[model samples]
Target: DAGITQSPRYKITETGRQVTLMCHQTWSHSYMFWYRQDLGHGLRLIYYSAAADITDKGEVPDGYVVSRSKTENFPLTLESATRSQTSVYFCASSPVAGTEAFFGQGTRLTVV
Candidate 1:
């Protein structure tokens, strides 16, 4: 069973292109999160949604957006992609915060 999945596991784009990454979970987890992995920052939260259409801004929300119209799906959008935004992105879901979060494989994004 595909517990959680992220689409287009790898991507390459220009500095100004807009890119969207998809995440879907089957568990109907109450909390969904988007995080970016970089060498210096490690894994940092980009955005998170507690429930459908109820999302909160994370540490790095700039140039990124997220929407959760359904409990099982959370999509992360880069309105204006940048080189600094180039990193491995991860989607995670959990029943609640401070608990073990189930994660997707990951989507590697590269902005040239």
Candidate 2:
């Protein structure tokens, strides 16, 4: 029963408030990513980490922050929540780039 999991499947926060979506994997995958899923944009990469202490910005990095202190955890934080940031966020981990990845159930965040 070891797999990726996200905390707070759903969350509601006010605009300007800061919110963080946590992701953890028991498999110790080397590649972890944070993506936001919206109506028209589909899945947009927000950030990713190749290894512990190594992170990089992705397609949409503005307004978001991510860090990976451990190989098994990747957390994404919205510095200042906004209505435009309201979307379903997904966390995925892969053994390597360009390979199949395992995803968490996702976190639904509503910024109002």
> Considering every candidate listed, which one attains the maximal TM-score?
2
The TM-score that candidate 2 achieves is 0.97
Candidate 2: segments with Cα more than 4 A from true spot? none
Index of the highest-lDDT prediction: 2
Model 2's alpha-carbon lDDT is 0.94
The models' CA-based lDDT, in order, is 0.93, 0.94
> Compared with the true structure, what per-residue lDDT tens digits does model 1 show for residues 1-112?
7699999899999988999999999998899999999987789999999989899999989989888989999999998888999899999999877899998999999999
lDDT string for model 2 (30-96, tens) is 9999999998888999999999999999999999998899999999999999999999999999998
The global Cα lDDT (0 to 1) of model 1 is: 0.93
Residue clash pairs of candidate 2: none
RMSD of each: 0.9, 0.7
Cα displacement (angstroms), candidate 2, residue 112, comes to: 0.8
